[model samples]
Target chain A: MIEILLLVHLILAILVLSIRSLFTAVILMAIFSLFSAVLFFVLHAPDVALTEAAVGAGVSTFLYIWIVKRTQKEVK
Target chain B: MTTTLAFDLIGYLFVASSVVSLYRVLWGPTIPDRLLGLNVASAQILAILVLYAAKEKLHVYLDVALVYDIFGFVGILALTKFLEKRHRKGE
Candidate 1:
């Protein structure tokens, strides 16, 4: 089961890497980070999961959005 | 069994998103966009590492994750500052 989960996680990671839009990528990455946090919880690491949720879903997403806003260029 | 399966599903979702994020990093027109992608990727990796540490029952990996968190924070701040400097210089 874990193997299958890992496989799916890997596939999603690849998908994230392929998308062209920055906004879309950031949103997707947030979703990805959330899942990773869940994975950590499943693996019996609540502390790690908490960190993931805070940093990945919260801080990282915020940073990306900030950067996107700062640039004002949506193309490419 | 159900719990494990749930985690598996979640992991797959994360993998999918990470893959999509790569395109942004590869073709981002601006440096900040690339930096954002990189930052998101690092966060995801940190999560993955923590999960692995738990699965493997290794406490040491937690330390690695902590270090990664610090490094990632500093790195992103540095990059942001650099970009701000460049933008100001361009003005």
Candidate 2:
């Protein structure tokens, strides 16, 4: 049901936010964003869902990965 | 009864994650970590808006979510560019 899906999404979001590795964080965040978009759709907000899908899954993740690649060597 | 319980459960889950995201924003080690936490929080805000829209049977919240989406993107891009500039200047 919706509750289960939401729980999974929350867990993923927590994993994304708490993980140490930048690369893994980006991937987990991408997944988290995708699920958030789906949650929006389930909540009957197609416009918000579309924006979330494009921005979260598409642009934000790409930006995060690009920055990670650019700054990977600097990490301690 | 089941449906109400389901909605309540999901709502609580969303709230819990939002709280955790706030914690990340508070204690994030680096600038990017802070930015990422902020971005995720905004995304969660959008999700909450969408949920409210459904619960209240109103479309106006969707508009707010759309605007928030644009603002979050621009803010993240600006922060990233600013960070990059600072890093370069430090080099």
Candidate 3:
């Protein structure tokens, strides 16, 4: 299970880089953060898991989206 | 023993994932892409810290994760806000 999770995580990280859309990258990173939170909880760090769940998965993505929103390419 | 082994396995896996995300931070074409990469790496680091705290049975180390959680969001939020301001000015 650990190996499988690791493989998926690494692949997704690579996908984030390779993908063209910044929106997709933000979403992918949020997903990755969720996975990391689960991984942390499994390891018995409940506090950290909670923080990652709330902050990384939630707030960070919101901030990224906010930035991405205004910086969008001007439609010609 | 099995549980400990499992924890170790998962922890290492997260660490490896963060390493891969570093490439995006270094070479991303757009600023948002690079920030996205940074966000991923920092989130993983928080998880790694928690895993380490569990492994060492040191509850206090969890404080680092908490602190990181607070500051990480603030920093990112501020950065994005700044970007938004600059972007609006450009237009």
Q: i-RMS values of the candidates, in order?
A: 9.9, 10.3, 9.3
After superposing candidate 3 on the true structure, give the runs of residues whose Cα lies further than 4 Å from its correct spot. A1-76
Candidate 3 lDDT score relative to the true structure: 0.70
- Each model's TM-score, in the order given? 0.49, 0.51, 0.53
Provide DockQ values for all models, in the order shown: 0.06, 0.05, 0.06
Candidate 1 has an lDDT of 0.64
lDDT of 1 by residue, B1-91 (tens): 8766765566566656665665676566766777777777666666666666665577866765675577456545645664576589783
Compare the candidates by TM-score and give the number of the best one: 3
| Stretches of model 2 off by over 4 angstroms after superposition | A1-76, B1-5
True contacts kept of 1: 0.00
Clash pairs (backbone) in predicted model 3? none
Could you give the candidate ranking by TM-score, starting with the highest? 3, 2, 1
- Estimate, for each residue in B1-91, the C-alpha lDDT of model 3 and write its tens digit: 9988988788778868877886786567777777787788887777877777788787666775776677567656755765577588884
TM-score of chain A of each: 0.86, 0.88, 0.87
Predictions ranked by DockQ, top down? Answer: 1, 3, 2
lDDT of 2 by residue, B2-62 (tens): 7667665766677668657755654666656767776786676567666666665777656
Query: Which tens-of-lDDT digit does each residue in A1-76 have in candidate 3?
Result: 4555576678778887777666666756765775676566656667777777678765787787777776863222
Chain B, model 3, TM-score against the native? 0.88
Candidate number with the higher TM-score (1 or 2): 2
